[model samples]
Target: MAAYLYESSVEPHAMPGNATASAGRVGDTSPNTLGAFCESPGQPYDGLPCAADSSTCEDRAQECHGRGPLFDKDLAASGELGGYGFASNREVGRRQVAGVREAMGLQGGKGGMRPVRSAHAYVDMGGYEFALANGTRVRTCPAAMGAFSFAGGTTDGPGAFDFVQGDNKTEGEQNPFWELVKVFITPPPSKEQAACQAPKPILLNRGFAHKPYEWAPSTVDVQMFRVGNLVMVIVPGEPTTMAGRRLREAVHARLVSSGIFDEQDDETHVVIVGTANTYTHYATTREEYAVQRYEGASTLFGPHTLEAYIDKYTSMVPFLANGVQGPDWERPQPPSDAPPKEQILKAISMQTDVKFDAAPFRKQFGQALEDVQSEPYRAGETVWARFVGANPRNNLLLEGTFLAVERLDAAGTWVMVKSDSHPSTVYRWQRESTILGTSSVRISWTIGSDTPAGTYRLRYFGDSKSLGGKISAFVGTSGNFTVG
Candidate 1:
């Protein structure tokens, strides 16, 4: 189910509703036309080819119009570091996905539902929240928000959990993307953003300081990945269509280079948009952007739009290539860097096996399994499942999976996969199945000697059967379960 609670009465549209007034008279000029927004220079970085103070209209016309070449020069100078080239953003995105799929090798004899799903958004302007029927409530947003970019009341507020959810308002020389990314992929104690309000460093005592560059920040965009119902979140910076396309291409290029999809359904892998989070921006065709118009020339989207395009164009891939067919779907082979299948499943099981000091299950179950089916999982110690009948955006059945990671590589780099490994298993209902309207499966697992005795989880990846299947479905419950 998809539900959308707009902050304003205005709906999401291609063109701005208040454009006429905000923009000059029709003949005078468009509000955000190529001449105004694109051709006009924008905020200049220290060495990017741009006019001094290119952040405003005045700068665009006076200094930027002529000096803008400097910005292009900077891009050329930085080369791959600036997220440029055919092998840049698109290549990176594609590689990341391939790496994830390679990392999550399927396991368990394929007869049960697995937690696997993906989430897409044109932009996550106001952020969003989700509560699985199991009572698992997860809230996500850009690492930082502010008056200029994210446009929410500044300050993480008194109840702020951590800088992970705070607002970033520092203009110029501050890279919110990098800050969030560092916190995401790397270790903890990620520095708090330069606060928009008081704008001061928090708990930062680094011995050295660094200069800002027009480089991709650590916080790329946040991606929701699922294998059956098990879900993991990878939030990166907003992907511009072409810009983000590099990331997507990166994955595909790897698959092609690594020969993962050669014998399988190459046409089946796809991308989709318009759901869950709306964190990125405009997406145009290569021909479209070449026009050098407003939408086409948007720097934000220009560098990142490829990801969105992939989402739109490839929406049907998972369903055709990986969705349930002949009763189940199988994950492809793992890369040399992937984790072991046993380890992945064990970790997934542990996430589901969350323990509680008190009686968590009694309070949740109450009576019938149906009663517990409508809510998310409270902290407990059983392999529990919840299904929501609707989503906030589409009001359709919402489904997803979440679990924990048991072990990282010794270097703590990427996940370590075992020989012939896959992370989770997926199952679909057949005409002869007996689990009510659902399908069923049985899995046999052996905890590795290296596995620490703790809570683990097993999840079924969630995938939307709608909208071309490029986008990942939301998490919710459609029915209850009685272990037979």
Candidate 2:
């Protein structure tokens, strides 16, 4: 019995010309100080003649530049991480930890951290660009996936939630449909990254604003990072060398101490960092803090060095490792008395019709059948199942299910594959379903172009109490679609 871990990031598509407008708490006030890019008057901006006086020309000029005027006003602006109104990664990380611990039966009673048969996590890096006088360029933070590796589960999972879609959906449909599922908070698959269209002015306007003299961000980049239970976010700060690194360390420490690691101590951990979520300010190291010093000093951690910086990190790690505990955050464990097999089967079949694909089943079954020289039609695979619903109304009905698919291979050996069954929008019951959602477990394998083609049978089992007695389907295969 193996468990799987998933991770990913969520971002609203506010790009221009989008069918619907985007909305949410876009910008909110942040701490007086952000990461390391110190905020104060007289900070140099692109070598422009910044006035030395604090309350006079310098601060006033910064306040005056609203949308443009480029560099001078930009001097006061730190990176976007410092100002946005998004859920803090520190909090997200803590919740993930608590959820898993409770789910595995480790938090309450006498049970310690339970062994996870598998783990999956995903994070969203807001975007790839950050603003500096020269121009926007690629930025990387420690936790944006580059920092660690994820083990124990499949890499494929749901992509980041579409905030733009949520905005367009009626209130009745605004459930956190994709919230708890895990995705890999990975880097842009390639350098040709996707850019969000400019958001509607209203959506853009919701961000933090500048005071008479206070600093603000001209742009934002949001990225998500995940390693095992840890989800790290790199928010851009004012473009100070130290801002990004320092903030990352602080937030990372906070999450580690929040019980994320402790909850999954037995599993191999991974870390994904970089700019993927909304770009906040850059989190820089102590060395960067010293080299490119700025007034944002108060915002940057004091002591200005990596050794000192790491020390601060160690202290907060505990908080991030063990989160605030109460009954509400606990995940439900399987009841002591296992339900009847019928109930389990029903639960497995309880999925709504999503566009389905027979590829996964075909591949897994095909491989086994070919290997053993048995007919692929009879051999099948079974997968463990779990259901995760967006709301409580469907919670009991959708939370967990086990899936078992079986077939006989070319040889007589009965091949079975089991997955901790779960629902996803990607799996469509048929190719032409009107609605789009994620569900289904696909198991696939490839045959060479020259290999013999034949008909096959793929059978699937959805075993869970919530399914209400639906029967599994069988797909008869035709010629192999193997590419030469």
Candidate 3:
């Protein structure tokens, strides 16, 4: 099959509510006219780029913010400070769709795909030892988050504090207050541990801290899947561009040498499938690790992390060779050490359970608090309705929606045209009175330019919990409004 590769951005940060927004755009099959690639960087307070090393503006990370293509427009339209980034998210998704279409058009499909083969293993990354290609022996340290992790987060979400990224300060140069606080949170790293994670000034010695449970994963899942000449390296964490490229090359070379695919086979492809199976954090090239940026600082297993993964994945290539299949196929021995089952069993959750939900006296659940306007609304205008609501945690509404935008058809029936899944639709819940157990929900829809001109109504579906904790469903409908 024809293969196409596109590298639009490195470490493209995600925005709030973007998960549903982007998914909606990708699912929408509508034609798009947006450009195929758009580079979005953090918006600077003074309209200048953020500091290269710390990603800060005036030495303050909170001043640097990521801006989407439609950031200003969305912010102005919503009037919500620090806009949700929905507009930009959808635009990016549209660009992705356009890119896919262009790529497919340029290279038509050709099929001779091979059967799928897979391999998986659970490895304790702590102290994993191996030899580099140059005959240098090295090992990975236990998982530990560095001070730069708190370097006011990333451009995607700037955090509080005086910390900054790319911080490689020696102990004396480090913040004296935080240095004392670190001892109270988790045990201070020993000299050996500190040396192992050199250049990464430990903020939290997660692997060594096991009070409530394992703070960081000591064991991670390593897996791979092969189809035809294409091999996917399933990684446990995010891998930077260079790190991922090195991994792919290492695996590709191994596959060629193993005779699974000849070096002359130009069709052979290896790709990195990141953040799969488990989470360890980020993987960066040794050079990037040395730089100690946000990504490199978050590289849990020290500077040798990428090399360790490359070594493990390359060693497992022989298992994916042709004819390695079925019950008859003999597999190598499994690792003796696996992650402790208690690590999960003893895991703790700080989130409190839903107590109960109730509507104000004489205001029944799902009762309309603010109905839609009677006047006609034009395309691109937003219409909304608010209702007395309950704690939605009472019912997640899986395979269902909390709200819908219905269009009145010629047959005199309301047809569900849009749900909460649509990028243009939003479902927001707010607690009005915690003591009274009262809440409200606002459902809004931004009418698309291409939306059909007709009468439409807003509907809300909710579930309320009684004093005894019984959940009952309710529905509310708003009066019809014209879209012209």
Candidate 4:
């Protein structure tokens, strides 16, 4: 039997008397500003630290785990529900919300806001050649994953086996087993290709592998959006901190030099929006690429990837100018390249369809199996209920929630104060019997300190499929409980 769980949090309400501003300034912040790190020797190896370079403890990558700010907090003792990482996730989200609120408060109104402008183009990155600022000719190789890519993944999601991160070994230094077997998986990198990806030690030459369909993207979207002095660089892949900084700085300088923004009076802001139009993989700085860490190994292209991106983005800056002179001026034409429409249309999925859903004998879908406690709950306490459920995969419920926390208002009406999207709530699913097709869902909400005293109930919404292939929606609500 297979089971699924979905966790969400309660939304934070805005403070009363804080009116919305018409305009505000957008600024860029370093992605590394958050104070958090992956903690090694998690759980089984609790007191030990992973090896510095490989992020492994006792030669096992599974021991390394990412920890949040509240990693030390006991979930049960604190009346919260979730696994090891939930507490930290909650704390990180809270910090981000606080930061956004502060930025909102610093808004100066919409008086100085500029008109919205945008630029877009498609570029084929495979063997893309360009010259650096120093006039040194460079070219990005076809998409390929390096040896470190199989280094047991990253700390966030550790992989099994003997692989570890930062493994930028040369062909001669690599494992003999992998060296012998890699040719069977994908074509071995050619001599020129091997030299192009110098220190990477190619593990998967995806660019050359095109059998059933394309393995990696060859063409990617280069897009940018501008509103007044702020520019958003839409990146096709995840960029490391240093790579993002370098790209932003280069774009900002280009905007100034291209006269899109005045250097003397206007302050230009550039931010990187990653994983925008397509998934090319990760982009890392040259130095980081040399280290061949997880991000660098997954860079797809060679060490010149970031430089190529910077070159492309800056070259398009003039297109973002507010016309050639005034509003009547026309923008320049963008670089032309065909998108990978065939690759998208031919995409395949291995996921199986949900044949049907069936509840236990004498039970109905959405029927309450376990109700909430009758006693009153206090701040920081958790309230939960379980219900007979169906396969959630039947319907994604896009823009809709499967669980909600309703409060009894003064008018005798149930008002939804929280949904599955909230951080304080968790929805867990378990399959009791696969042959019988019986399943259950548990919904829990941990009351926040700021939650007002009132009567509340947990409500679950679901869709079930019948033997005849008909689908129906249902709702289940638990007994009302008081919060004091």
In order of appearance, the predictions have TM-scores of 0.22, 0.22, 0.87, 0.87
After superposition, the stretches of candidate 4 with alpha carbons farther than 4 Å from their true spots are 1-45, 74-79, 107-113, 325-330
lDDT of 3 by residue, 1-484 (tens): 0011122122122212212111110110222222111123453346666776686777777776666677666567444222676666667676665666575477533387566787878787889999998999999999888885545576666666887878877766788998988888888899988888888888888889888787888788888888888888889888887788888888998998899988987877887877777878888888877777778778899889989999999888888878676632355423435754556678777888778888888899988999999999998788989999998888999878999889999999988887776667889999998888999999988887878899999999999988898889999888899999
lDDT of 4 by residue, 1-484 (tens): 0000111122235212233221111111222222223344245656555666877776777777654456566234554554545666555555655655676578453466467777888988887899998999999999899884555677666766677788888988877888888899889899999889878999899999997788888889999888877788999988887888899889988888888877875456787888778888788889989988788888898989999999999988887887644442356657858876566567787997777788888988888899999899999888999999988888888778999999999999999988776667888888888887789999999898989999999999999888888889999889999999
lDDT of 4: 0.77
Ranked candidates, highest TM-score first: 4, 3, 2, 1
What TM-score should be assigned to candidate 1? 0.22
* Residue range 197-256, candidate 1, lDDT tens digits: 123222221111122221112123334343532222232322234433444454454334
Clashes of 3: 0
In Å, residue 370's CA in model 4 sits off its true spot by: 1.4
Q: Rank the candidates by lDDT, best first.
A: 4, 3, 1, 2
Please tell me which model should have the higher TM-score, number 1 or number 3: 3
By summed lDDT, the worst window of 10 consecutive residues in model 2 runs over 146-155
Better of 1 and 2 by lDDT: 1
- Number of residue pairs clashing in candidate 2, backbone atoms closer than 3 angstroms, sequence gap of 3 or more or interchain: 172
lDDT of 1 at 236: 31
| Model 1: how far residue 422 lies from native, Å | 50
Error of 3 at 65 (Å): 1.4
